[model samples]
Target: MKWNSSHKAAGQHVHQPGDKHAHAAGDGHNHTHGGIFGKNTELIFSLICGGLIGIGFGLSFIDGIPPLVSMIFYITAYFFGGYFTAKEAAQTIARGGFEIDFLMFVAAIGAAILGSWVEGALLLFLFSLGHALEHFAMEKARKSIAALTELAPKTALRKDGNGTNEVPIEALRKGDVIVVRPNTKIAADGVVVKGSSSVNQAPITGESIPVDKEPAPEGSFKIEETGKLDDKYRVFAGTINGNDLLEIQVSKEASDSTLSRLVQLVNEAQTQKSPTQQFTDRFERFFVPAVLILVVLLCFAFLVVDETFSTSFYRAMSVLVAASPCALAISTPSAVLSGVARAARAGVLIKGGRPLEDLGSLTAIAFDKTGTLTEGKPKLTKIMPLKTDVTEVQLLKIVVAVETLSDHPIAKAIVRDGKEKLGGEDLPAAHDMEAVLGKGIKAALGNDAIFAGNLALFESLDESKPSAEIVAVVRKAEQEGHTTMLIRRNQEYIGMIAVMDTPRAEAKGALEALQREGIRKMIMLTGDNQAVAEAIAAQTGITEARGGLLPEQKVEAVTQLAQQEGKVAMVGDGVNDAPAMARSTVGIAMGAAGSDVALETADIALMGDKLSLLPFAIGLSRHAKKIIQQNLIVSLGMVAILIPLTILGIATIGPAVVAHEGSTLIVVFNALRLLAYQGK
Candidate 1:
């Protein structure tokens, strides 16, 4: 009954080791009854002790039965209920000095020795009940981390040339081909050699639509027509393959897949300690020992000042128990768990508490121009014929023919445009087709040579002859905020293709929200030229822009921002953004689709490439941190006040124990407030 309804439903189907439900259904009444017995142990013991004490008082009035027999029964009930807790506390103290457990044990034992048997039994029962509740609360918080481990399939269906074989996901090797059925989760990262399907990539990319996919023939599938499928595409893991049976060649093993890498990254993030946790750890180093010494001093002062030994010992024990700092110990973990759950519900998958803690302090955010700020999908914006003899159709025909063999987004845009303008014609065979990273491509089409790419790709060829016309076209496209790729046939510039990376529909609002949170300095870093980057930045409300940056240059830009500001966050999505993401204070990956590097290297992943979530994540982190501070303050203050009150004899041992346990309950409830964090 303590389990949330959703959690109980999820537990019904999946059975994992150490899972609470693993024993819950079978024991059913046994476990519940056992819990009841545990709760009543102290109450039952207290009632017996109280009855014996009352009998002793009554025997004195009756003058028949002896008081010694009643006293003996009282001792038996007191020891029976409180002995285990005291022993456990003593064991805890012997192992590592002292903790709340040790303090509670000492207080219960001291109360019994002082002839307050009923009070001792009640304290033990209440403490045990409170501990059980805390345990349940902590378990619920850990569900998110446990959920990650649950995503990996137990076994994978491996496809061999002869037939299919069932193999554990752990046994999978590199280059193993796997077949995925419709609506089934892709088990590994791979290239599709055969098949066409519309894949629902929402699990990974955060996009709701199912993207069209086809076999990557030749090198990769090229989108031949704009907004239409021509039967060529590939799908990756974390994607739901839709309504089509497709054969895919596994490129990476199960262990090396995007999901596996994401798990590893999240595990690493969970292990990394936040700044606040570090401070608490340092404080505990001295705080624990200092509190112990204070307890000893209180005892010594009472003994030297003519107070009875029993009174002094009991008072000292109460002070020690009340000031043990159990609430402080639970504060960080409670807040972190609540924050993580809140983030997951909002579609922001934060790997751990460290990033959540650091997010509030982010001063500058360096975003990748394409994919992060602009919509990653490029569109055919313009086409210009450079040579007087060349027609737009003629140039597009050759460009599409070569680009049809490539799977890059830019290549797809070129092919899509060409298919529409030139119509489907038998394409000439392109030999030795090679793509230059961050540049253009070169291929041999029979006896002629073809060169297509950015301006840098044509640096080796003479440009003066074609400079006037090419510059005019490039400038015209740039002024129109389009990225232009020049086309050349045997050193003569024939035509130019213009592509546009549109600013995301939600980018302006997301940026404004960040600005309101005091993050005023927003910058864009991209491989595109200054003109294209600036134009896109302007539209997104970004004032500073750096363009024409390589992968290394992006890292440098992030590093420079970090040096200039107190904290810098990088938001990007691409294999090229890995270095920059790793170098920033907090790295946020956008549209985490099939990019393993983006998911692994970035600290936070926005499942869908919604720019609006960036500000929301920052705001959520700030709110979570505030809750943590409040919990810590309330917890520590309670201990401070109770410890003094116990030492000053203003509060008895029974009230002190109640106050200490109550503070823990209050701090826990305060931390749970993080689950309600909603971004403004």
Candidate 2:
């Protein structure tokens, strides 16, 4: 996984000119001011001012109070509600800029001048209310990053020659040994040197259950290592340790731990603007000034048509109120933020809004076979003995001993099965076990020189041949999508072992869900033989399966799929698939619970091993995009409709203000709905 740290680098621009609008929206999450009143206080004060305006409007309708006192109430309402907005407008103008704030201020003040003081106050209050809600929604998005910060442990137990000492995590260095207590969070990314435990990885991987971790036996070989630390022998910061003491060798600095990186990525992703936001900003750059000019022209036209000056000006103010693009400016960011937050909660880490949008538009998705569609661990299926004075158990013991030092998946499966079947009986240790990469293993056990591997390994040996029955069994096993290893003892064919990996339980449903969500194409890519790949594909309901692919071949296949199918997301959990993942439209890493590389490289990361979140994430993105489109239509549509109505004397200042500000509220509420999406 290649992390894009440039996005999180200090001094990268996070300052937006219109940032002041955050307060008006009633965003009360964090207050920058070290003052007594925070955003909640500000929101309450504004709401009280709004009530004052309501009272002032009510007084005008009663026969008791003087009109002068009613006017004072309206003036006070306008002052309090519009105070921050007017101040922001002045600041923007001083900077030689104009934005949505300036547009709202101009429209409100113009209404007040035309003797529609109550309408002006109402406009300010509604606009502030919308701003407050938008800020609150955006705050939820930012909280995802804060949640990551909360996951990291503040201190660690460092072991030295003298004794164990508690030290701040920041003071710890790579290669330091730390003692982690049971039930405590890990303080750094490290490997286990001693002890074992079940680790709760929910904070990082979103796995609800705790994963058991044990040290790998020294000198045991493993197949398909993934170039990543195995959870059995590794520990990470932020994961809760189970009831066992552990001695860990720190492999990375505290600042460079996986939890820190997650926080940085989320921070940068939030600050990065999407294309829709960029376009809206560009439109507002010119649209705000253009609306001001159009209002002046429309008012003059009304005056020339024998309308009273005050009435014409009043019509112009109404048009101005309707034309502000507050809703449009907020549409995409609010939806993007909400979608990202929802994804985080579901254990999917989306890099940013751009990927979220791309995920929504994906036409196809390609999956890597191993550890993705199938349980990555292969299991022993059958054993066939060709010629033997040798019993099945005897041959199995010999094979396990010979394959003991091999780190291949098939070897591990054999060793695992041997332990289960043989019941703790110690086998004769094989010496001088030589591994022939991609073929098999050779070893000397007691007197006989044992050979175990593929048909290619046998063919490479001098005059070593399996009998006809053995060849038939091998063919049947290969045809049935099982990997077969020919076992030979002292230049004689002895027997064979068949192993196979099964499809994951959720594979079928997850694929169908993707299809239901409008993914037009799905393909499985694997390095296994055609029969093995095809068998898993058939069971999982994938439409196409490609086999015998090298790392580069997978990359080529992904590139072709992206061109033919348009926008493809490749999902995998191996280092071999990284190139292919990078070549696709969106690269998704699955079960990336502790892999820093997978977390950093993939555009979309599924933290847990389950495929269930894939459909949920895609559905969320689509829904968010739909809401943004709805908001744009409503914002632009209102301007088209209300402008004509106000100019023709069919609508007044008060109604136009309500409709315009109400559109912003509608957009915000629609975006907020994403927070409740549980994924269909």
Compose the digit string of candidate 2's lDDT tens values, residues 1-680: 11111111121233222110111111111222111356454455468678999898888889977999889998898877777667667776776777677787787787787777776787677656545543433333333434456667788889989799889999998778899898899998777777866776544543222455766565442222312655567666888887778887787788887667555533432333344545665776788888888888877875568877667777787788777665665666567667778888998877655567767888899998877888776788777777758788887888888888765556877899877888888888999988765577888998999999888787777786776777788987888788889999897887888888778899999999999999989999886768888888889999999986755577678778876866778887754455455455566788553244444445677877778789998999888888878878888887788878887889887788778778877887888898899877
lDDT of 1: 0.64
Model 2 C-alpha RMSD vs. true structure (Å) is 10.2
| Model 2's TM-score against the true structure | 0.59
lDDT of the candidates, in the order given: 0.64, 0.70
| Candidate topping lDDT | 2
Candidate 1, position 52, lDDT? 56
Give the worst 10-residue stretch by lDDT in candidate 2. Answer: 18-27
Top-scoring candidate (TM-score)? 2
TM-score of each: 0.57, 0.59
lDDT of 1 by residue, 31-92 (tens): 12123346444335435545555555455566667757655655665564445445545555
- Clashes counted in candidate 2 amount to 9
